[model samples]
Target: MEYIASEALINARASTVWEVITDAGNLTVWESGITAIDGELRNGGTIRIKTADAGGRTLRLRVQQMPGEVMTWTSRLPLGLLKRTRTFTLSLQAGLTHLTVKEEVSGPLAAFLGNTRPDTSQHLNEYVHAVTNRAELLDRAS
Candidate 1:
């Protein structure tokens, strides 16, 4: 399991954060690594996020939970013969929010990511920075 996580406090309200986070069609508004996404927004719904990487691989993303200040999703993708599970969790705090993403690679290729993926903390840090930029949207309107 190659686990990583991040936490951030935006200079905005939870309601504002919730709106930006739940807007399924607008991931490019924050996540820098996502180029585009097309799909539905609901429990068990699927979505495809065109990542920063070229060719825009349509990742297998599904909402693990929905309805409330917290939402989660699990993304499955193959790294060679191994399958990877990436879990994203979001939680609201006092006028702030917390977001975390964890990745677990298993099967025959498990060692591939667990051994080769360098700078795990750097990825999480970038994610937090990208998502926290949502504060700009809230600030602009307010």
Candidate 2:
């Protein structure tokens, strides 16, 4: 199991950040590392996400769940010789929103990730950047 968690202090309120984060189509705006997000995004709905990291490696991900505050996905990529289960959790604290990303992968291919996950680690930063970026975007939108 591998976990990467990042928190950010947004000038905007948590609800504002949550609205931006929940806008599935804006993944590229805030999370530049992700190439695309597709499918019906709703509670218990399955979706497919494509990620092209800074290294320009395109990876495919299948989302498992996307209920409020909790999003789970599965990657065919191996992590410690097992299929990886990734989860993104969002919480509101004070005026800021906290996001935690968790992953567990087991498979021979998972070895590709090794002990370090560049994409997942990058995602931690993305979460933080996304919230703050959205806050500013929203400010301008208003």
Name the best candidate (by lDDT): 1
Q: TM-scores across all candidates?
A: 0.71, 0.67
Model 2, 13-104: lDDT tens per residue? Answer: 55566566556787666654556777655555566666664365544456554444776766563343557676767677775666666666
Compared to the true structure, candidate 1 yields what TM-score? Answer: 0.71
The lDDT per prediction is 0.63, 0.62
lDDT of 1 by residue, 1-109 (tens): 5556667777666556666666777777666566787886567788777665435557766775546454555655455465555555556667556666666656665
Candidate 1 versus truth, CA RMSD in Å, comes to 3.5
lDDT of 2 at 141: 76
lDDT of 2: 0.62
Which residue runs of candidate 2 sit more than 4 Å off their true CA positions? Answer: 54-67, 76-81, 107-112, 115-119, 139-141
Give the distance in Å from residue 95's predicted Cα in candidate 2 to where it truly belongs.
2.6
